[model samples]
Target chain A: MYAKEKTGGELSVGGPSVRGMTNAIVVERLVKRFGATTALDGVDLTVAEGSVLGLLGPNGAGKTTVVRVLATLLVADGGRVEVAGLDVGRHADQVRAAIGLTGQYAAVDEYLTGFENLEMVGRLYRLGKRESRKRAGELLERFDLIDAANRPAKTYSGGMRRRLDIAASLINRPRVLFLDEPTTGLDPRSRLAMWEFIAELADGGTTILLTTQYLEEADRLADRMVVIDRGRVIARGTSDELKAQVGGQRLEFTVTDAAVLPRMVERLRPLGVDDPVVDEQARRLSLPVSGGAEVLAEALRLLDGDTSRIFDVGLRRPDLDDVFLALTGRAAEEVASDDDTTAEPAMTGGAR
Target chain B: MSSLAATLSDSVVITKRNLIKVKRVPDLIVFATLSPIMFVLLFRYVFGGAIGGLPPGVSYAEFLLPGIFAQTIVLGSTTTGASIAEDLQKGLIDRFRSLPMARSAVLVGRTVADLGLNAISIVVMGLTGLVVGWRINSSVGEAVTGFLVLLLFAYAVSWLMALVGLLVRTPEVVNNASFIVIFPLTFVANTFVPLESFPSVLRTFAEWNPVSAVVQAARDLFGNTSPLAPVPDAWSLQHPVLYTLIWVVLILAVFVPLSVRGYGRAAGR
Candidate 1:
């Protein structure tokens, strides 16, 4: 059966089972609903034991719902899910023991100190008192929160609090770690720092399933991605594969003046392989082309003598953004921004 | 270890986490104490003379101290609802669920920690009652029993609050809604006035109310009962301890499991 190829033999490594197991997470035809709303609709996903599977979707698309279900925090109405080789529905405690989850918002207790939060998590994991304290100290140091360890979590900045939250999840060094928009509200620098920390964990062979609206995050850390919209998987592939599906390259340029855009478009259209798209605000125009470099160079040659100056010019292949647009029929960022306005601003239903 | 052992240990850990919050954020406890003190001072000086139908020869403060103890603890239990709702909003309950700990730990810990806060409020209010001429005329043994009954009843009600807290979305909603429910419960009883003063139909409901039974039980135990206090013909007031214990058992039997179920749903969602 297909299940035989997925669940592997027992663990050999000490932390995270390293490369021993083949599938850390698997969901088939999963279904969930809240009142009249079906939050998850027959979705399937599989993450090899040590790889990262990014659950890429807009907010309220039920990415958190799927994560919650896999983490044994939600009961699926239909189908089967196994995490760390244990059935999520039947062996929920075992599944919970094998996984760690850092939610969309940091879930650390604000009244507890950073050290206290980690230690409490460890103690709940059944680590003895001494060991719990030891692990708490180690994790705080690893997260670079040692200095603030004695202060309540409420005193930490957003990024510091997020780090402490992630550290609490790792107190037991779970085999499968789920991060729900781990960098949602951070500055660009903190986002990069978080990416590096997540990458380091991935390098240690910890399986990760992350949901994100930031395409750049998926592109940066995910080995494979499943794009879901409105509780359904619309596309799934490696970043490049998704990009390639919405195929072809575009010749793009920004002219000095908005009025000269039509002239530039006219010059590049004939050399173009397909229709051109213009940006009035950016004073930019792009044309799909068959010949890679040759067409780009040829387009520049034709526009060389034009009176209007060119601020920027380049030939570009599609990224995950284009793939998301092609599959969802909407921009990823737009759907994400819509969430900020439409959904409850804080963690609520489906957070678990 | 066994499942029960694990649950107990997990509960202790979570209880410690909650107790730490009380220590760090003193406002909830402060308000818990302050409100009861306000009630004592108001009832003793302001309302004491205006409240007619009180029996002669007994000071209002002496007649009313036991009722205050019972009422304070019940109102104080709302802290359970507020604190639990705050945890639900903060997503900390979800975090606890993700661990391998006992599913019952979060609810158990919350009620227990709130019990501690209730105990503190009771002590502070007791001291305030003393300063205001409220005295325990009975022996230490009976007073101890009185306080135990009060704490047990409050603990049971705290579980009911736990269920509400888990069912609600925010601490503010829990605070507001619980007051709407708890106010009538405490006020309609023999807490602020004598049973004879209540209209006949309302008097029946007030006498039988679990809040009244506990208050009556505490009044008898503390030797605080006087001619000024309500003397009802109902069996509930005649056997206040037994009646209060029945309510305690009844509330526990229903709300304990319901709160646990609600907690599971809260975490999963």
Candidate 2:
């Protein structure tokens, strides 16, 4: 409650233009290995002050590893990491004071009441008794957890537990916050509530670095995004820029005959921006194209030999799911199984 | 001095949080009390005539009191290790690690809370022992010293468990590991039987075991020692009080630093 909020110098949620401000998080050539597996390999990233950078990747993508290193929870095997200008490994205590971390799982004390959890974190932050209670009360009210404030956190729903987790992180009003998959296992309703709450924090000028296998989560929350797969940064840009990487919309059509797929591909090549991807098993062919409806019109005119033979055809913009598949050649959900899914999303590199 | 104050203050805050966990869930307190109640009833009625009857010049219940105290308090230390491991698995340790507080606060707080919990169980068991005709023949000062020594030794054992808890994979592993080690460590000594009743090699082990020294020391202080209280064959049994104190200090010296240092690297759990 005592934390101050600044005005002006605010950028829109989607715009990630960081021309002048100092970066809150600077990570360069970071590497972390577990036994024989490398979790992070030569990864580099910078998040501007008062901006949100979403670390995006599939399972075994090293997103959570990067978060742990920046939060000072784990030591990096190599490279450098600094949070709010303090080196995480060297000035850990100071970096700890400046930042709040909501790990991949909700880290709130389940045995303690929601109010007690926030108050305890406040005391850990060295806030005096009265100030701690006051801040805890304010946060509980702000997170809409005042109704269940006195109940043990274990009794709260998944969404409430996550809200309390985030509220605890804000106890010290940290300059930067690390949220690793803040909405990983939540129902859609709770996940949306969490997204709005996080959006509010960023709007208030707190710098944030969040990691998620949910591409849409990163797309909605992060101003600048970096995609890491197999412990390497494969792509980095704004949400729009990352979307642009896959290039416009995809045009897909299903041919009635599986035998005619190759012939259809040759006829569609001239209309496509890139070579069409053929799924012979599904009798489907999809090509990336710059134009939307016009590309479809030309494709139908070009492949008019057997218009009746086409079962399905459509043109649509590439969503995050398509981006993930395009970049990593696998769906995001495929990387996370029920066992290791809710835990660390990206711990293993090569195998399940 | 300021650093000392900071460490103490941070430890106090952490201790308060840990204690609150017990308070919020009074089931933990009830569970802690239940085990001591079970032990007292079982040892008094079931194994009383045989194991409890070996010592001379005192009733089996009275003679068995010191051994019970030593065993109960030592087993209580296992809770310390298990609780720390549980905290690690639950991500509470990660939360504490990310805080700008003293590095040793979490472990210190956990051990102190476990110590407090152990003391409660001791009092509960002491009352149960009294109901079964166990008496303190010694003066109040000596009785206090006896209980204090048992607590100190238990606290030392807790540090060892704390280190084990940090290095292990899970809280369940800590429970299993403590049972494997503590059961043999406490049972192989003169905890349940008199040294003279054991075979030759077993008698020597019973005479020199630190658990035996702790029990013998408590019995001497409580004025419930057998006629052969001195156990002159072994130096440890001869000076039970001094030997137990030496073991206490030695374990504390080795384990406190190891647990604290291990906390940093133990996050994989």
Candidate 3:
């Protein structure tokens, strides 16, 4: 029943380079519910082989639910889901063999030494005794944990535990990796280190499905992104395409005085897609515009002599944060505060 | 390797992981060994001469030894539940579940590792019992059989606790919940006292209680029972070995599948 391909009729959403690649993960009309609350509603997504697909959403948007389903940790209520070309429901063990999962919480056993943790995970992955030890040593060195390999994980810092967790996930050298908010609680320095590590993994041709609320992380790592909100897909595209969907670029000018704002707005009016927004207190004027650098040039030409009043002018492209807000109608920071009230241990916390 | 062989290997790996914690955590060693010795000392000195209903030629200390063995082993089984709940709370179970291993390995590994702890506790308690006035009058084979029965009953109880752990999914709650059920289950039976002294209604319940049967079986195997004592009229107490084995088999049959299924759907909450 799982051998037949169901991807034949689906439209390709990625670039030509991604078109020829087989999908490592495929989810069609997925549905998951907890009691009366629908966690995922008819969600559809695919991650091409050796490519990173960012599953972007707010705290409760079911991003973790999608990852859990693909990782074979949670069974979907209604869907045709496949990972590594194996049905998640029927061939869950085969799917697990091909996938690696690093949950939000560092799942390392605190009492075990770092080496023991990795070696245990390797053995569970069916790596033989000698091979498990060898792999544990290799992963500890690779994750820069060799110095602390014999220390219990309870003594390690949060970042070290997270690294150990990720290293344990790579015990089998999984083809598809699911990292659900891998850097959620790390400090800025540790977050940067995690990003570098993830980049290295992505470069090694591992298909990654990364779920994160950090838009900057997605913008940097993902080849394509599927944005979900309130258990449904709201947008799906590359970073630039999603940005473009949020009304293109903005032309902004920091003026010498608030008086020149109206004149500047009139001059840049022809180039903008919408009416100009003027701020009197800050002496700033912004116009939503299209056509990129040429539009800035056109605006500057229209303001030939009036340029003296404008101290700074540039075209600003919409960022993922803006796209997130425009799509979800809630800022990422607000969604984080909302998550604290409904926290459950295993469901939406880390495992799911 | 075949699938069954793979499951056995996987279970051994997980069992090793759990045993490592026992060596590292000082608190666990204290709880496993010290508490049983404390119980024996408290009962032997504090209440040993106070309660007396034993028949001729049988010492209260000898009778209390098998009861202590049963109680300690049963209480020791709670560690399995607490550890499992702790794993679930910290998301370690999620990591294990996502791996390409046998589904039953986690529970099997936990119960088996805990069985090791119970063995260590028995050795400690056995030495402590000898220091008081407890002695095994039976042959070596019968004594070893007595110890085996204690461990087997504890193993079955571990599966029952595993289901509780998966249901509650918190170490603290599992501790409290198991205490509520296990306290009366062990106390109201023949564990700490003879079933003959109980009021007629309580005596009937004690005679059939699984803990009483297990304690009675241990006493019979160790030759702690005196011929002058009243013979149990209840069939379960009369054939204590068979009754205990039946309960062990019945508990394993009901709880093993319940726990595995509960674990699979635990993340759903």
Candidate 4:
């Protein structure tokens, strides 16, 4: 199936018959509970046909559970999931054919070479022998793995293996792709490379649903984002909208000397700097400001003589981490180590 | 018409992938191939003289070859369970479960690949037996039929192993479980010696044993005289063909559905 090129930016791929309902994924009041603990409670989400929706949460926020249900790998205890306009429970085979899944860890066969792995997946999707090999070759080139295609997967680096895994999932040219924590343990460079590839896929009109703990990744790639905690949707909005909910900007300044911290705080007080706190050890003064960059410039002028000697001075806006803390009542960093953090933001569900 | 043809075509592709896996892992082939040859040699050379009561004009190698044929097929089938368990441990099966391919094709393809390996092992063991003075007096068709019977028995055993592989959570547990049951069953049958040599009560059980039937059928088809040929009871006399076919059908009836059910349960569907 192929789409005709249009003047508009939308790059549709599949036939018109498959695009009747433009929503790629729809979950209404989705709830999944593992024994006594509820992993997903009343989670509602809708992904557009050709956009990337990032499901952002800390560990145990049911990101994996949601993906599993959508992929038809695990059945949800309650609520309904629809993929590619087919009911996941009733038409699981249809749903599976329409969606591709790349789990958190690489799932390529270690014994097989990169090319062989892709070819195997291609055959499994029922492509003819010649067509399977052609598709595998194209994927290998696109993923920048052609050179290492003949090497066994076990010999590849972590990044190469992850790339191979993603390539394998796309053998069928699925309409919807699910990536669960795709870059959890990847190096920064490889993570960025993967993000670019994901963005490229979205650009080519593939609906993508991804889960990640990294807020920056969500901000960069997701068209719409949802913050989940303790198996519930705590916040959902565009990046700017979520940041707006957690009001004000951060104004940070570091004095040249430890003794000058008090003076710097006093000089910047009239510039609408609130809650000024001094760290004697690092000789830094930080405060919240309601105004934007202009206020920061004015504050710098007030300390004109010491501006050059200031260790650091900047106005920072609120990010998803702030929204997470404000909504969940705990910093995202603190919750990273707690597995039950997704079960209950409060201290109810004990350590797993 | 086209869609049905496409499905069949896809199944062949899936089957080829499994064959590639079998080829890549030469160690599995080596184990399946060498184990049978070694068993045939050990039984014919080391233990043949120790056991008596072979009919005149029948060398121990001739009598031992058919039993070794059955033994080799059974041993090769155990790898089906081991491979499945290993795949489960490595999360390969879980990955396959998420894919859109035919569900039944996955396990069936694995069994088919294992059956091919079993055939190779059977041929290797047969050649080794010939080198050791074992003669097959039967025609080419009879000899081929003997090998087919052994292969059918191996196919049935593979299904049982597939069920065990799916039910058990760990590879080590599958190994221990299959070995504990298979080793004793092989020993008590006529794999090493004729059933008449056992205690009278044990002889009755061995006569009805599926393993004994397989060995007896192979021995009769290959024209190798067995010590139990003198038994005149209709049930015992008919053991050569009927019992082997019965066991094959029975195993297929039980294990094919058992494995599919186990897969559903393991997937938490």
- Every model's DockQ: 0.78, 0.74, 0.69, 0.40
Kindly list the per-residue Cα lDDT of model 3 for residues A1-352, writing each as its tens digit.
Answer: 1111123224542222233668788888899998899999998887778989888887888999898888888889997898888899999998988999999899999999999999999999998889999999999999999999999999999899999999999999999999998887777678889999999999999999999875667888888888888789888877766776777778888888889887777767888788887889989887887675888788888988767778878776665455765777765556653653233222221200
Better of 3 and 4 by TM-score: 3
Which candidate number has the best DockQ? Answer: 1
Per-residue lDDT of B161-228 in model 2, one digit per residue for the tens? 98988878488899888989888888888776777677898778778889999998898899886674
User: lDDT (CA) for every model shown?
Assistant: 0.83, 0.82, 0.85, 0.78
Where does model 1 exceed 4 Å of error?
A: A1-21, A248-260, A279-284, A289-319, A333-352, B227-231, B267-269
State the lDDT of candidate 2 residue by residue for A319-346, as single tens digits: 5456778787876657643334435333
Candidate 1, B1-269: lDDT as tens digits: 99999999999998899999889988968877898999999998988877766656566887688778888899888888888888888888889888888889988988898888888988998999999998888999999999999999999999999988888867899889988888898899988888888899999999899999998898889887765644569999999999999999999999999999888878623
Ranking by lDDT: 3, 1, 2, 4
Find the 10 residues in a row with the least total lDDT in model 3 chain B.
B260-269
- Residue A17 of model 1 has an lDDT of 36
Query: lDDT tens digits, residues A44-119, model 4?
Result: 7777688788888877678888998899888888887888988899998788878888887788888788998888
Evaluation by DockQ, superior candidate among 1 and 2: 1
Which portions of model 4 show Cα errors greater than 4 Å? A1-21, A33-38, A243-326, A329-352, B1-7, B200-204, B226-228, B232-237, B264-269
Off by over 4 Å in 3: A1-10, A13-18, A247-321, A333-352
Clash totals for all candidate models: 1, 1, 0, 1
Fnat by candidate, in order: 0.81, 0.75, 0.84, 0.56
Better of 2 and 4 by DockQ: 2
Candidate 1 per-residue C-alpha lDDT over A93-176 given as tens digits, one digit per residue, 9 for 90 to 100:
888888899998899899999999999999999988999999999989998999999999999999999999999999888999
TM-score of every prediction relative to native: 0.90, 0.88, 0.87, 0.81
Residue range with the least summed lDDT across 10 consecutive positions in model 4 chain A: A1-10
Question: lDDT tens string, model 4, B149-243?
Answer: 99999999999998888777567787788878888777888778866688987777777778888888888899898444576343854667877
